[model samples]
Target: MNIKRIEDTLNEFNKIGYSRHGMNRLAFTKEEEKVKRVLIELCEKEGMEARIDHCGNVIMIKEGKNPNLAPVIIGSHLDTVYNGGQYDGSVGVGVGVEIICSINDRNIQPERRVELICFVGEEASRFGMGTIGSSAMAGKFDQEVMSRLTDQEGVSFPKAVENVELDFETIRLASREGERIHAFFEVHIEQGPVLENHQKKIGVVTAIAAPTRLKVTIVGKASHSGTTPMNYRKDALLGASEIALTVEEAAKLEAVNGTVATVGQCSVFPGAMNVVPGRAEMKIDIRGTNVESKQVVVLKLLECFKDLKNRRHLDIQYEYLVDKAPVKLDTKMINSLSTTCEELGVPHLQMVSGAGHDAMNMASICPTGLLFIPCKEGLSHHKNEFASIEDIAIGAQVLEHEILKSM
Candidate 1:
């Protein structure tokens, strides 16, 4: 395989505004359209059969010697977080395409077909719906969640589908026919410093951490800062700060495999500096490899809110934004990757994914495995995200070996 060509393709994608230091291809937007177009063109150039689904997912299939067998699938999302790193999703899809090219170049025909997929809207930034395309393909989503979501512009989910000329009914039924998948594999950046920190080239992911997103709103009476006595004030901002700190402390106490809690978003009502804030709303994201550890963290958060309700005599409301159980990768597939890496002289280690990916959703439908390469400085989803060219090439080689083994 020509690693330079793969790196060149990635660089070209970066030039397409796929990376502004990092990637900015949020789902269901014009940037997404550009990404889809580029991928379709690449597949066509390679003489692979390519098509888009009702949910705007891009699929490229390379025919094999035996057409009767189910295809071995390799993929990742094309959509990215705002200013996310280039390699996060792009590298996975790029490596899959490269594997196909390698197969064709060597005239190595497999018994099963191979597929490359670029799923749409895996990021929840736009429609507050993460894994929309994959979840629909897994038969896990329904009309209720679809109808309730609206973009920043107030475009409903159904309307967004319509805008893309997709029929909602067709997308809802996309999962029924995809069960023929023999197995699914994804190659992604580690999105952390683990591999680099350990001086490893590959990460054979054992499992993906489950993530729970909660929106907590603290309601307290707004009063004049100057006029309200310290003892008499029912300050929502103060209560929220306490809860936020409590969440951090709880994670530290329950640190099972590095369980973490983050308050990513916080809003205060009434922005005036002189006025006491009446309400504060914050989004809490928590993750852990084990459910029990996650539950402990969540229960501690609830307890913090309950305590604040009593101490401040304030009203509190909680809303669940997202709750997904952790997914363990197929052990067989992981073993295949590990063995291949060892045989090929690739540096590798077993690890769990800290960030969420489309691979998690794919696991619900078929046996899946995720491979990871390191990110420089443990940075991702930011402008400074980076991985070395050598690392990228090594990751692609590992993925190539894994795909060949799976076939």
Candidate 2:
């Protein structure tokens, strides 16, 4: 395996989204398209057939000996969040390409074809609707879903498609069905410090939990900051703060399913130094591997909101942006990953994912597995995010060997 060559290709891919500070390949943009073209060029050099679907997903397939068998899919996104790292999604796509090329280099004919995909709009940085390519491919997309999505700049989904010079009507047709899919695999950076801290090279993900997002609004009457007594005044920002603490307490003490919660965004209305806050909006994100535990957290949160509204004489409202159940990956793939890592002398561990990935959506259509390599200090979605090429090569070798074994 030419680890250096693969790493070099990753570096070149990084330049496609090069920014002064970090990477900037937001989904469905021209920059992302260039990344697709670069991958297509790599596919052409390897004599693989490359195709792009309506949803702007790139798929390259290396035909195998038996034309009758289902293809095994291996892929990851190519788009990065704003000023993000290179290996976040490109690592998996690059490794898949390398595996297919390696097979062709050795002239080994396999029973099933190998496919590498670069899913478009996998990052929420573009439209806040991520996994568009994979969700469309898995037949999980609809007109209502697409119509409801809009970017921060007020660009709608269809409009963004036009901006990117892609066909939106064709996107409606980007669903896969009736085709045999052996399995789907994704190799990614751990995006966490667990692997690095544990001195493990590979992570065999057992499950990926779905997160529930809520946009909460707390309203109260504005009052004079210094004149109003604390006992008489209802501070909206203070109410939001109480809700945030309640959210954390519920997740930490009330949940038994490894639940976690975060208050990522908070904003106050009528910002002023002397004015008491009248309205506040906050974004809460909750995730867990166990379904019941997720429910418990939400229930407790709602109860607290009701109590706060009545006691503090305030108005509290929340809307869910994302709500879904946890997904358990393919048991066979998990076991196979373990065996492969051991056989290859790569240290590995079984764990569950706290973050979301395209693999979760892919699992809805086909058996899927996620393999993770360690990143530096578990930092991702940031400028300093990094992963060692050697670590990735190790994880990729195990992934490649496992895929070959299944064939």
Candidate 3:
């Protein structure tokens, strides 16, 4: 494989959403379209046929010797979170392109078709909906679900599709026949410290954590901070703080089980410093591979909410935004990837993914596997997030081997 070509592909994509903060290529934006054009152009130069599905997934196909066989699908999302790192999604897509380029260089023909897909709207940063394209293709989504997804600007998800010239009404057509897909594979950064701290080069993902997201709202009376005595105040911010700590404590209790919880977003009402906050809103994310453990944490949080409502005399209500079950990938696919690593003399660890990805949804339709390469300090979703080109090249080589084996 050509390492320079892979580096060039990633660098070209990195330039599309370049900002002082980092990459800002949110779903359905012009930056996404620009990157799609670049990918299509690159694939076309290598004699691959490319097209955009009704759901806006960019698909490029390299026909093999036997066109009748099911196609092996590879690639990842092109969109990034707001100010996210450059390597999160783009690296996988770049690897897909490089794999085909390597095959072309060797003048070899495979036994089955290979496809690269850059799924659109895989990040929840914009429409609060992640894996949109993949879910639609997996038959896991419908119009009702799409209609409920909206961005911070109050733009409906369907409207965003229309803005991008995609046919939202015909989205159901995007669903692929299960028999047509031989397998699905994705390459991503570990987005955590495990592989790096363990001195491993790759991670063979065992399972993906299921996320339960909740939006909590707390209401309290706004009052003067000074005039109101300590006992007489109804402080919403204080209530929010307590809830945050409660979440932490609950997750800590289940740490051994790998259950984790985070209160990622908090908003307080009232502009003045003197006024007791009238309301506070929080977005909580809880995830784990064990359903019982994650449910225990959720129950603990609910109990905390009830106690806080009574003792603090605050009105607290919570709504579930997402409640999904954990996904275990295909064991055959997992073993294949691990064997590939061993054959290539690569050090790898079998691990679980705490972060969600398009592979989770793709697994519903066909056999799927996820590979992880370590990032610096396991940092991701930030401007400083860095993954060495050498590591990426190693990952690409492993992925290339697996693709050929499957074909």
Candidate 4:
């Protein structure tokens, strides 16, 4: 494979939808459609067969000597976070495609078929769902859960499926087919400064952290801010703020090996400067590779909320959005990746992924592995997200070597 050509390909991909800050290819939107089309075009250009699956997954096939063998799947989602950097999902898909192109260029044929997938709806910005496509493919989508989900526009989950030209009932049964999948591999950015801070080139992920998302609402009586004395007020916003702070403090106390908690979104009902908030709703995300520690943190948070409710006379309610267990990568696959990195002379480390990826869903069905390259300043899901061209090329080369070995 030509390193310069691969770098050029990445550059070309980054050029699409070049906003002043970053890219805007959110899931299930027109921009996402354009991105998938571009991927299909690239696959076709490389002489690979490409098609969109029932749930809008882009599957590009490279036939091997024996078509009967289950294909080795490699890919990541093409959808980005709102105003996210280009390399987050695009790099994984781009590198997977380049692997096919390089195989064709070298006239290499393997004994097992290779399929590159660009999964849809990996980000939860749309329809309040994450890994919808992959979860369906893995046979994990529950109709009861999906039917209750809604998008930003207040569109129901079934209506969203209709808009995408997919039958809801069929999608509910989408998981039975992926059982034949061989091994799945995904390459992605670290989305943190670990590699960059350590001056390393690659991160071979050992596990993907589980996320515990809680939606907490505190209710109090609304009163005039000016007229209500501080002693007489039971401010919901104040109670919510205390819980948020306690959550942050808990995460800080548990901050060994990438444990983190984030209050990503918060809202005050009747958001007026002159009125005390009657209700405050906030989304709290707690993540950790250690399940026990995560549970401890969550328990502490709930206890704090309970204490605040009893003391402040506020109504507190909690809704869980996510509580998935951490996924450990297949040891065999991790060993293969380690051997590949050593052969390629790339300095690498076995680390746990702090952020969620599509690999988490795939791990439930088959042996899975993930490759991580450094992101500038450990920053991802932002406009200023960046990964060096050199790092990108090296990551692709490592992936190419690993694919060859795996095949």
For residues 63-96, write the lDDT of model 1, one tens digit per residue.
Answer: 8778888788888877777777777788888788
Q: Would you give me the overall lDDT of model 3?
A: 0.91
The lDDT leader among the candidates is: 3
Total residue pair clashes for candidate 3:
0
- List TM-scores for all candidates, in order: 0.93, 0.96, 0.94, 0.92
lDDT tens digits, residue span 1-407, model 3 = 78799899999898899999999899998899999999999999999999888789999999989989999999798899999998999989999999999999999888988999999989989987788889878877679877888898999888888888887889878888565689999999999999999999999999999999999999988998788888987788889999999999999999998999999999999948888898999999999998999999989988988888889989999999889999999999999999999999999999999989999999988999999999999899899999988999889999999989998
Which residue pairs clash in candidate 2? 192-378, 193-378
Lowest lDDT 10-mer window, candidate 2? 170-179
Among all candidates shown, the one with the greatest TM-score:
2
Please state the error at residue 113 of candidate 3 in Å.
0.7
Candidate 3 C-alpha error for residue 34, in Å: 1.6
| By TM-score: ranked, best first | 2, 3, 1, 4
Which of candidates 1 and 2 is the stronger one according to TM-score? Answer: 2
Error of 4 at 212 (Å): 1.0
- Per-residue lDDT of model 2, residues 105-193, tens digit only: 78887789888999998888877777888988988878777877888888888998878777777776778855679999999999878
Q: Model 4: which residue pairs collide?
A: 139-175, 192-378, 193-378
